[model samples]
Structures are given as structure tokens and as C-alpha cells.
Target: MGGEYELNFSCMLKPYKRVLLKLSGEALMGNLGYGIDPGVVEGIAGEIAEVVALGVQVAVVVGGGNIFRGVKASASGMDRATADYIGMIATVMNSLTLQDSLERNGVQTRVQTAIAMQEVAEPYIRRRAIRHLEKGRVVIFGAGSGNPFFTTDTTAALRAAEIDAEVIFKATKVDGVYDADPQLNPNAKRYQSLTYGHVLAQDLRVMDSTAIALCKENNIPILVFDLTVRGNIRRAVIGESIGTLVGGFCEVS
Candidate 1:
């Protein structure tokens, strides 16, 4: 499974041509309490490169909690809007780091920020972003929907719909969606498949309400899987059935 042939084999089995990947800033923290972990970023980049090699188009929406959480700041007394703007900047920083790592992995990438910073990354243009993906360049979206009070999860769903992605791949610490926090409740049941209505009604908390609703309205599917598992990203892309599939009715293996 470590050779070029295997990579090609996986690519050949992929059911999706394009996808939107949602990365939480907290996941980039590795074991640290805050900030990006270089090793973790590099590993993620390597995993992305594998997907890219398999000819799947990838677009990413990254959160900024590792550096700053606007909601937390606002709750602590900063103006909500201002705190959220600062949080957007944090995402741009993470986006650049991800771009750098992807480039180092020999994968072409683009960092498009919703907030303009010409000196660093390109401003977000939906058409341009789609063009990059078509060219096999990884498009990394930063800044939370270019507005305050919006989570990166929403950004991922919005971008996925805009780009007409087949699915939204949510990489989380937990392997999949559960009836309860799996770590806290060992007996919690993991759902292999779920409907959008069921998730909303159950208050799954898998993604923010705004994000989940957006996907539901657009009929986009979501796959929630563990990012900690080194090859899970590539596995999910190639339809290995390794996650919790939400929104669409699909047979689960």
C-alpha cells in the first residue's frame, strides 16, 4: 500500500471528483494548547498531497481557534465584531502555514483570504478559487465567511456549495458522529449514516447550525472522520467508508 501503484489504485476507486475539507484550528494545535504544530501541519500536507495525486480536487476551510476564538473573546468583553475580525486574521495565518506545508510536500496550493491582504494571500474570488481547483491546485480558504459571528464550518459548507463539491469532509478528533461524546460515554453509539433532519433534531453539534442547514438546503453530503488517523483523509476521499456520512442516503459498509 506504500507504492505508486497503490496510490493510483486508490485514486481509481474514488467516487468524488471534488471535495471541501474542513479543518479545525484546534486540530492543528497537536498536543499544544495553542498555535500551529509544524509536525502536524506537515503530516496533513502530506496526506493532502496523496489525495491530490489521486486526481481529486481539494478545497479547505480552516478555523482559527488555535490562535484565537472570537466567540471566547467576545464573551470576555471585547466587541463581538472586532473580536471576530481578529479571529479572521488568525485563520489567514493558519491558511498560509498550510499552504507552505503543502508546497513543501510538492503539491501546488493557493491561499485565498476573505479579508484582503495583498501582501500575503490572494483575495477570495469564487471563480478563481474554482479555477485553481480545476488546475489541481489546493485552494485553502481563510477568514470565516468574511463576516463576524460565522464559524469556519459555515464557510466550508458555503464554499462547498459554491464550488459544487460532492461532499464536505469534516476532520475531527473523534472518528465519527456519536449519540454522545464518545470519550465521556464509552457506550455512546456511533452513527454510520444519518439524515440532515435527524442531526438537527438530535442536536448533534457536529457542525454549527448555520453550517449544517446550509448543506442540508443544498443537498450536499458531509463525512465526519478522525483527522488523528494519519491516512483517514485519503481513505475518506477514495470511498473507504471510514466516517459518519450525513445528509445523503448511502449504503454504509
Candidate 2:
């Protein structure tokens, strides 16, 4: 599909009014293994800029696995809720860094938090978020639903549903879904596309069960793609085939 619609039997369609992109904080870690990497962030922002140039309304929710993992803190004897709160704050850090990078590149960005901190960022309000989208401003939701024990994956589903996004784009290191961990299983078969029921029944690790169920219930598709591949974000947004589409009936590759 040469940047134009193709009538191929396996072509992916892009009729979405809006899209929610879920970025893992680890994706921004570059080679440091911790904290934000300016180069990586800029590359990611550049990809978003390309998508935005296509007139797509984008909303992003970034995880904080780059800064802290609540599960890890719990193993260290911290209260789960306290540890989760710390994780939420970590996400806020990523959201700020992303917003700063996008702003520096002339992309109007907003950082909304699940936990209220009026002086720093705007509190997440669905209507306000939609308004921002309508105005072509990219919104980054941070702080993970203002609750504990829920992963940022769940936050992406919840916000995507609330915002009426047609699909949830889950960007990861891998380009698509596989039956087993690609790192562990050298012969693992990669799925070109998968249905919601198939994905749930097989217990795929693309997203948490709660998030997958939420997206399934709301008829929102999840596109799992490799964002580390420069320009994949724009490709995914503009209907390029770079990942596994998780929703609807299973289609053979």
C-alpha cells in the first residue's frame, strides 16, 4: 500500500476517528535501562508528529516501568498501595518528559493526571480531553487511574473507552503478537492478526486480562506494534501493516 489505499485481501483498514496509543516507559529507556532517554523520546515524538500530520486525533497513555515497577516495590516490603502510588508518580514523570519533548518540536501537548495536582498538570476530565483532541492537541494521560493494583494497561483501556477511541495501539519492543515469548521460543509463530476471543482464550501476554476484556467489551481493537522501529507509529496510525491486530474474528495470515 504505497501510502494510498490498496485493495489487497490482507490489507488493514484505517477508518478510525480517534486512536489511543499506549507506550511503555521502557520504550523510552533507550540503552540506559532506566529513566527517560531524550533521543528515544524525540524519535517517538517524531513518529507521533507524522501521524498527527495525517489528521488523526491522538491520545497517549505511557507506563512507568522505566522508573519504577510496583510489583518490584511490593517484593521489597512496601505496601502495595504505596508502591503503586509511587509507580503512578513515575508515570507522571514520563508524561512530563514526553510533553516537554513534543512541545519543543511544536506539537501542542497536554499532561493530565489521574491523581489531582492542580499546580503541575491538569486533572483528567473526559470532556476536556475530548475537547483537546478536537482541537488537534495530543493528550498524555498519566498516574494510572488514581487507584492501586491496576496496571497502566488497564488505564489505557479505560481511557480509550471513555474517549471513544476506535482502537488502542499498544507499542512494545516486538512488532507483533506471538504464541510464546519470542526471546524464549526461537520458533514461536508470530500472529499477523488475532481475534479478541482468541487472544483472551489463549491468554496472550500482549496486555493484561482486564485491559483486553475491557477493550473486547467495548469493541475497541488493540494494535500491538514495535514502536522502537522508527516510523512504525505513523505506519500503524495510517493503516500500515506492522503489528498484530487484536480484535474481531481471527484472520489467517
* Alpha-carbon local distance difference test for all models: 0.88, 0.86
Per-candidate clash tally: 0, 0
Candidate 2: list runs displaced more than 4 Å.
1-12, 249-253
Residue-level lDDT of model 2, residues 10-104, one tens digit each, is 54556566999999989989889789899999988988877777789999999999999999999999999999999999999999999998888
Strongest candidate by lDDT? 1
lDDT of 2 at 81: 97
Worst 10 residues of 2 by lDDT: 1-10
Show the colliding residue pairs in model 2: none
Report the error of model 1 at residue 69, Å: 0.4
